[model samples]
Target chain A: MSQEIRKIEELARTIRRDIVEMVYLAKDGHPGPALSITDIVASLYGSLLRVNPSDPEWEGRDRFILSKGHACPAVYSALARRGFFSPELLPSLRALDSLLQGHPVMKKTPGIDMTSGSLGNGLSIGVGMALASGYTKKNFDVFVIMGDGELQEGIVWEGALSAFKYKLGRLIVFVDHNGWQSGASCNDVGGCVSVKSRFEAFGWHCQEIDGHDISAILQAVKNARAETNLPSVIIAETVKGKGVPFMENDNSWHKRVPSKEQYEEAMKILGGC
Target chain B: MSEYKGSREAFVAAMTDLADKDPRVVFVSADSLKAARATNFAEKYPDRYFEAGIAEQNAVAMAAGLAACGLKPYVVTYGGFITMRACEQLRTFCAYTDLDVTFGGLNGGMIGGEREGVTHQALEDIGIVRTIPGVKVFAPADAAETYALAKAAGSLKGPVYFRLGSGREPDVFSPGTEVELGKLRKVLDYGNDVLLLSSGFVLDRVLKAAELLKAGGIGASVVEVHSLKPLDADGVVRELERCQVAVTIEDHTVIGGLGSAIAELAAERCPCRIQRLGIQDVFPESGPANTLADKYGLSPQAIADTARALAAGKGR
Candidate 1:
C-alpha cells in the first residue's frame, strides 16, 4: 500500500473508533449508519477534500454534505479529528446546547457545509452549490453522502435530474449502500433496482466500489473529478456497523446504544483502548 | 375602471431590477417562467436563471443551496406548488437554516387559478408558511405592493415567502407606493365604528365594502395587512380598540390565516368582536375568478354585510 493510502486507512480506523465512542457516550445515535460511512468520510476529509479546518467557511474550499444526517457521528468525528474543533467535543454528540447536533446543522456545526436532517435534501443543495461555483467561477466541488434507503425519497431523483440538466460536473454523490434501513433491509422496504442504472439513466457518471477500501474510494473521487461534463455517483458497498465484529450487519444496532460489555468489545475490535 | 398591471409582472420587474443591481441575484423557476412572468428576467440574465422543470421541491432546496453560497436566489412558481408541494423543503432547508431565499408564489388565493381550479389556488399558503418559524410571509394587495415587497425582499437577511396574485388582479394601490415591511398601511378611516382588516388581492373588495358600509350609515376604517408574519400587532390592536368591531377580509381560508392572526391577537391583547370574512372552511369549486371570490365569501357585498352586522352588534 502507498503511504498516503495507509495514512487514510489509519484515519478511517480512528474515525470508526470515534463513531463508536460518540454513539456509546451519547446513549442515543445511529451508530450503524455512522460506522458504515466512516471510511468514506475519512477518505474525503483526510485525503480528498480540499478544506481548511481552521477556516470552516472558506469560500474557495470544497463543500461536503452528509445527506443521511443521522450518520453525523462519523462526520463530527472527522471534523474534530481534522482540527475543525476539539476531539473532546465528540462525546457530547447529542447533548443539549452542544455545537454538534444529532443531525448536521451547518449554522450550529463549524465544518458542516449544509444543514441536513431530512433525507433527500443534500443532493439538491449540492447541485445549487455546484451551480454557484460555475456562476462565480470558484471551481469548487460539492460532495454529498447519502444512505441507500434515502434513495426512496422522490426529491433525490429530482435533484439528479437538475444536476444532469445543468451539467454540474463538480457535484459528486456517494450512496453508502449498507443494505439495511431502520425497520428492515433496504430492498425489502423500497428496492431501488440497480442504483448504477438509475443514476446512469439520469445521465450521471457512475462507479461502484468497496466503500471501506480507502484507496478505492479515493480513486473513484479522482475519476469523478476528471469527468467535467456530468455529475458522478459512486455507489459504495458498505457494511453497516463495520469494524466491530458483533455489530457488523446487525440492523438492531442501527440506533441502539451499546452495553458496557458491547462497548468494550467494540473498542477492542476497533483496536482502541 | 382603474388601470392595473399584473402582480406577477410587477414581481418579475422588481426581481429584474434587483438582478441588475446585485450580480448575486438569481432566479430558479419550476417550469413556470411564463406563469411567473419571469421570461424578461430569464432573457436579461440567462446565466443566472435556472429551470428546475416542474420540481418545486428541488427548486426550493436548490435555492436554499444557492442562498447558502451567499447568493440571493428567488424560487418562483405557483403558490400552491411552492407552499404545499415543497412545504417540507421550505421548512427544513430554508426556514430552519434561515437562508436568504426569496420565494415568489404566483396565483395566490381564490382570485387566481381562474380555470385551473382548486388544485392551483393557494388559499392556505399564508397559513402554512406563516406557521413555520423564521419565515417572513407577505401577501401584497396590489401590483405596486408586490413590486415594492419583492424589491425589499432582496435586501432582507432571511427567508421570505411572497404570496402574489394572478396577472388580472384589480388595482388597489397606485403606482410608486412605498410599502414598508411589518407596518400596516392604512387605506381609509371614517369614524372607526368598524375596522375592515384586509390582506392580499382582496383589498379592493374591502375598499368597496367600506363605501357600502358608509352608505349604510356605519363609519368604517380600512387597513391593509401586507406582511402576515412580524405583523404590526400594536397598530392592529390600536385600530381594534378604536372600532366597535373588527372584520378581517382575505383571499384565503378563515382558518389559520389573516382572520386567525387577527382573532389570536385580539384575544390576547384586546377583547373585541371580530367577524372574519373569507372562505368559510370549504373547498371552492372551479369557476371564473370573480365568481369563485363571490361564492367563497370574499365579495365586496359579503365584506360590507359582515362589517355592517358586526357594527350593529348582530354578528357571530
Candidate 2:
C-alpha cells in the first residue's frame, strides 16, 4: 500500500471503531450510512482535504458540507480524529452540554462547513459556498457529500443548475450511493441508477468510483482537483454497513444502534481499530 | 399624521436601488418580477438577478444556498405560495439555519390578485409565520415604509419577512418618508383615549377612520404596527393599559396577524377591552383590490363603521 493509503486506511479503521463506540454509548445513531461513509470521510479528511486541525477556520481551507447530514457520526469521527477537538469528546455526541450535535453546527463544530440535518439542503448550501468563493475570487474548493436518496429533492436540481450556470469549477459533490435511504434507494425513489451520467447531464464533470477503494478514491479526488471549468460529482459506490457483515447492504442498520456484541465484532473487523 | 406608502411596488424599488449599488446583491425570483416590480432590478443588474420560473421550493433553497455563500438573497414570490408552497424549505433550510435571506411576500392581503382565486389571497401567512422563532415579519402599509423595511431587512442581523400589498393602490407617502422595524409609527395620538391599531394594506382605512372619528370627537389614536414578530409588548401595554376602548384592523385573517398580536399583548401585559376587525371567515374570491377590501371590511368606510361599533361595544 502507498504510504498515503496506509495512513488513510488506518484512520478509516480508527474512525469506524469510534463510530461503533459512540453509538454504543448514545444507544442511538445511523450506523449503516455512517459506516458506509467512513472510508470516504476518512480519505477526504485524512488525505485529500486542505484543512487545519488546530485552526478549523483557516481562511484558505477548502470548505466541506455534508449534505447527507444524517451520517453525522462519520463527520464527527473524522473531525475528532483529525484533532478539530479532543477525541474524548466523541462520547458527548448529541449530549445536551456538548457542542457536537446530532447534526453538524458550523458555528459550534470547528471545520463543519455548514450546519445540515434536513435532507437536500446541504447541496444548495454548498453551491452557495462555491458561489461565494467564486464571487469573492477565493481559490478554496468546496466539497458536498449528499445522500443518494436526497436527489429526489427538486432543490438539488436547482443547485445543480445554478452550479453549472456559475461554472463553479471549485465545487465538487459526492453522493454516497449506498443504495438505500430511510426507506429505498434512488432507483426505487426516482429511477436514477447512474448518478455519474445524471450529474453530467446537469453539466457537471462526473465520475463514478468505488467509494471503498483507497487508490481509486484518491485518483478521483485528484482528477476533480485538476478540472477547472465545471463543478464535479463523484458518485461513490458503497455498501451500507461496509465493515459489519450482518448489517452490510441492509437498510435496517441505516439508523439502528448496535448491541454490545455487535459493537465488539464491528471493532474486530476493523483491525488496528 | 405620519406618511405611509401602500403596496409592494416600494419594496421592488428599494431592492432595485440596492442591486444597483451593491454588486453582491442578487434578486432570485420565482417569475414574480413583474408583480414584484423587480424588472428594474433585473435590468439594472442582470448578472446579479435570477428567475426560477414557478419553482418556489427551488428558489427558496437556492436562496438559502446563496445566502450561505455570502450572497444576500431576496426571494420574491406571492405570500400564499411562498409561505404555503415553499414553507418547508423556508422553515428548515432558511429559518432553522438562519440563512441571510429576505422574503418579499408580495400581494400580501387579498390584494395579490383578489379576483384570481383563494390560493393567491394569502390570508394564513401571518399565522403560520408567527409560530417560527427568529424571523422578523413586517407588513408595510405603504411604499415609503416598504423601502425602509426592505433596507432594514437587507441590513438586518437575522432573517426577515416583508409583507407587501399589490400595486395600483394610492400612494400613501408624501414624496419622501420611511419606517423602521420593531418601531410603531404613531400616526395620530389622542391622550389616554380610543386607540386604533392597524397594519399592512389596512392602514389607509385606519387613517381615514381616524379622520371620521376625529370629526365625531371620539379622537382615535392611529398606531401603525408594521413589525409583528418583535411586537412592542411594553409599548402596547403603555398605549392600551386601562384604556376603555382600543381597535385593531388588518387585511389578514384575525387569527395571527397584527390584530391577534395586539389582542395577545393586551391580555398578557394589560387587560383592556379591544375589538379586532379583520377577515372574519372564508377565503375571498376574485375581485379588484378595492372591492375585496370593501368585502372584507377593510375599506375606509367599512373600517370607520367597525371602529364606531367597537367604540360603542366597549361602552365608550
Q: Which candidate wins on lDDT?
A: 1
Q: What is the C-alpha RMSD of each candidate to the true structure, in Å?
A: 1.8, 2.9
Best by DockQ: 1
Model 1 iRMSD vs. native = 0.7
Indicate the DockQ of the complex predicted as candidate 1. 0.86
Query: How do the candidates score on chain B by TM-score?
Result: 0.96, 0.92
The residue ranges of model 2 lying beyond 4 angstroms of the native Cα positions read A184-193, B1-9, B16-24, B51-53, B178-180, B190-193
lDDT of 1: 0.89
What does candidate 2's lDDT look like per residue over A1-273, in tens digits? 789999999998888888888888988888888988888899999988898998886766788888888889988989988989888899888899787888887768877877788788767667667766766576788998998888888778877887787787889898898889887665887785577767978889998999999888889888988988988889899998888798898888988888878888887887724
Error of 2 at B91 (Å): 2.2
Tens digits of per-residue lDDT for model 1, B1-316? 1123789889888888888889999999999888888887788799999988879999999998888888989998999999899999899989989899998888788777767878988889999998999999998988888888877777888899998877898887778888877899999987788999998888888889899989889899999999899889999999998885889998888998999999999999998899888878887877888888888887789888988888888344
Interface RMSD of each: 0.7, 2.5
Per-model TM-score, in order, reads 0.98, 0.92
